[model samples]
Target: MKAVTGLGWGALILTLALAPLLAVDLILIYLLEDTPFRILSTLAMLGCFYLLSTILSLFVDALTGALRSFVHSNIPRLIDTILHGTVSGISLYVVLTLFPSIDLSTLTVMAIVFVHLFGASFWLNRENSKEDVPLELDSIDQQIIHLLRTETIVSCVERIQHDYPNLPKRDILKRVKRISQSNKVTEPFHGR
Candidate 1:
């Protein structure tokens, strides 16, 4: 899996964590049935929810990184799932406390979190595992390949990186290596 940056994970987790707050807020607005009070309550609730979600996201990101270093496997996903579940549980408890007559169940909360986490995992994994198709060398790529014949890979990578600051060094190295290997295979077949 492509490693998620702390900021990336933080944003994702914060968004997911807000789901329960939105649900509860809507429920409260409906139950209270007072427009002015609803507006004030919603504003206050949103502020609290935003603050809490930010803190929760940072905690999860730090914990995920720490666990990843220790476990050295796909433990981040497990950590994320557990953290999200805990957040969902806490949110559900708070919602129930505020409105005892609310008809939400623990299972319902779990199901929502599970579905959200599962979908995120599936999407991220799919994106991470996708392989680039063998490139049809464009003019610039061909120029780079030609340069590889006379230049060291490091030199080519440096030159490319200098010219294309947005392109990752590793990607340039991979492309050069792939092009070189393909040339070797074709040269033997073409008697060149």
Candidate 2:
């Protein structure tokens, strides 16, 4: 629990720390260029792009989660990040390609920057989600799952945290989510 919390806090602080740098970079890019209006326009456009990315990410996460239900596996954090980045890149590229009178000299660099940003944010989100994992649960430990299945989410999560402090929360949570959704495990719960 502490390990997952610490990682989550670190990632949040790191993101807060990066926000100013992103703003500064945009400002510098604007200053180096001759047109001030382009800077403002670019900034607004980027803001819209980010909002789009946020919406797309939520949609993708839900979609991926649903897809994983059938496969009995969650999307790995790294793969999720890359997929979001790819989706964002394609949208930005399409907009750039279609915009008239705008020179796209910086489009490639901007795509790279956006990908890094999205990947970092997704990494942080993935880490934060580890708070509920029960990574150390073994097949033999299924004995106690009787109690866990009856416990509140918070209680069950805390017990798992306390009992398996060294385990990976992501792995634990992934397994728990799978176990909850699976008829194989839930049948007993339903019968009870």
Candidate 3:
């Protein structure tokens, strides 16, 4: 039942994400003349937009901090939204520049930017709200940290999975990494 609900929600989210892209494609079809390269150019523009936006988003996330941190504060969420919108908008510009035949008006560009901003904010809020991990480390977290001192993260993750089948590997890795970072800050370094 849970899996089914998750699947339904996933489908809805996917549809929402693709909505802007499809809208642009429709607009392009209407605006562009029926040239031999129309279809080919349209497909290329779509591919470039997706590829460039995705790559830019990753870099933006790294620079601004993990989008998941939105769960902790609305500030990160707001920052992420702005950055995402900028990246998407820039990607659109690059694509349009590459394919000069596919010309979009200022109004269209603004509309796409607006959609990107809203979609990014909405998506981040929804995703962050779904998972609420405790800030404080538990015994299991301590064990993971201890193992990290002597074992590889992969090994620690494998051991954790073997011992706690219900625990998520991603969450475990996150906890271990966060705890390790905090420990580094709190502990003093001794220089030889």
Candidate 4:
């Protein structure tokens, strides 16, 4: 359910970000032919583009996640921006190539870049700040700690996610690390 919601949001955001280009394409298609058949064709083309872009967005999301895990550290803002721009630009180019009739104008390109830059900066800042938020020892934290005592952090996170679908997995992992470290420090005699 959560994954579906996230995918839906991803599609909506992709649609909004691509709106200008899509509008231009629609107008160009209509101008090429004023008949009802042309209008229907234009709509069909737009639908195909939307579906393609959404799938591409999901691919980008998964790629980003994989890259993030491999790095094992927060990506700098500059690097993050470059990564997003390069990926999005390539995705846009691929999508445009599929429908060769659509002309890529400067204004459409600018709008897409501007939107992508804004979203990337906003997301990076929000992600970086997640670590700063204090984690209280609520029921969830307690559950995380309990699992951490007998399980690896990865398994603990998976269990917590299964039980609490809405909670952020990163936060749960952070809590597990914190609690385990604190336990090691406060109960030094147990290790010996």
Candidate 5:
């Protein structure tokens, strides 16, 4: 939990830091090339892209975690890798924009980088999902489980003794037979 909290904080800091750096880089590129506000728009677009991706991943993970009640899965790890690669790529693009010319060849290189990184992330995600889960128990939880078990066992024993004073444990464990039948019950319907 602490590690996750720390990572979340780190991402926030990176995003915050990247915004101004992107802006500065874009501005410098625009100045050198004598371009217009298109660079600012590009920066904003990149920011929104990362922001949307981050939100979507977090929301998906939250929903999945709520449903499954566990995080040991490839899906979350894939989300993390994509986020990491995106941050790295964004930073690299900002730094590289300072060059005199960002030729088509350079962009091809960036595209290749994206594909390779995403592919590796995909493989890691697959491998992570294939892992066997270890069976481990927490002492505190185990203690609580034992207490619940004892309480339920004691209740059943007392109930049987009250119902059958002399019957053996096997005979005391008779089927629960209702003394009287009751009318059918209905819930207030919420119509579809």
Candidate 6:
């Protein structure tokens, strides 16, 4: 599996966050008689759901990335889906509580929406992963890339220990600095 780029992550998050809210809004409009209170309440509920889903998505992504090495990738993905489903379930429950006039059948519909959202999110993540190719680097080159990406010498040293225990930190730092300097050449452009 490959890491999702920052733009891909943003797009996925926005889609997962907004899609269900749009469904719920349409359902609310259809089920309720036209009234100011119903419209206001539905708008409020949409706002709350959007805010919660955005925060939850970001938190889940970070948590899954941090735990990447400890567990199988699918495990975290499954856990995130379940957690998102639970959030949807909670939102439905809250709506039901606030508006007792809504029929019990609405819960079943909401449950379907929850399941659909989970599946969609999982599918989106899978598709995004397909777009990325894992970075290929030798051990020393990996350390150098890490240093350049993170701009943290200490993290580079720690990465060396974790990935190449026998390699000395000083040697890695020296080679990374040399590579960094050598890659900084500027050339004047000529007409083709």
Per TM-score, the best of the predicted structures is 3
The C-alpha lDDT values of all candidates are 0.59, 0.61, 0.73, 0.65, 0.49, 0.59
Q: Which stretches of candidate 2 lie over 4 Å from their true place?
A: 1-37, 97-101, 106-125, 128-192
Model 3 C-alpha lDDT per residue in residues 23-126, reported as the tens digit of each score: 76556445543434466777678777877998998898776665446555345567778889989899999989999987667766777677667778888788
| Candidate 6 stretches greater than 4 Å from native | 1-24, 27-37, 72-76, 95-105, 108-112, 115-132, 135-192
Query: How would you encode candidate 5's per-residue C-alpha lDDT over 1-192 as one tens digit per residue?
Result: 999999999989997866664555454445445334455445654565455544655565566556555543335565556655665465545534543234224544365346535654775577566754423544432332333333443454456556557756643333211101112222224457
Encode model 1's per-residue lDDT on 1-192: one tens digit a residue.
Answer: 345687789878867876675666555445544334444555554455445544675677687778776775556355566675566456545644664444444454455455545644564456445634454667657767766766766787778789888888777777777776764423222224
Better of 3 and 4 by lDDT: 3
- In model 5, the runs with Cα more than 4 Å from the true position are 1-37, 70-192
The C-alpha stretches of model 3 lying farther than 4 A from their native spots are 1-20, 23-37, 66-75, 131-192
Worst 10 residues of 6 by lDDT: 182-191
Name the best candidate (by lDDT).
Answer: 3
Candidates sorted on lDDT, descending: 3, 4, 2, 6, 1, 5
Error of 5 at 134 (Å): 12
Count of steric clashes across candidates, in order: 0, 4, 0, 0, 0, 0
Model 2 TM-score, 2 decimals = 0.48
TM-score per model over all chains = 0.37, 0.48, 0.51, 0.44, 0.30, 0.44
**Clashes in predicted model 6:** 0
Candidate 2 residue lDDT tens string, 40-86 = 56655555555565677778878877888878765676667767777
- The lDDT, on a scale of 0 to 1, for candidate 4 is 0.65
Clashes of 3: 0
Model 1 stretches astray by more than 4 angstroms? 1-37, 76-79, 91-192
What TM-score, to 2 decimals, does candidate 4 have?
0.44
Give lDDT: candidate 1, residue 182: 69
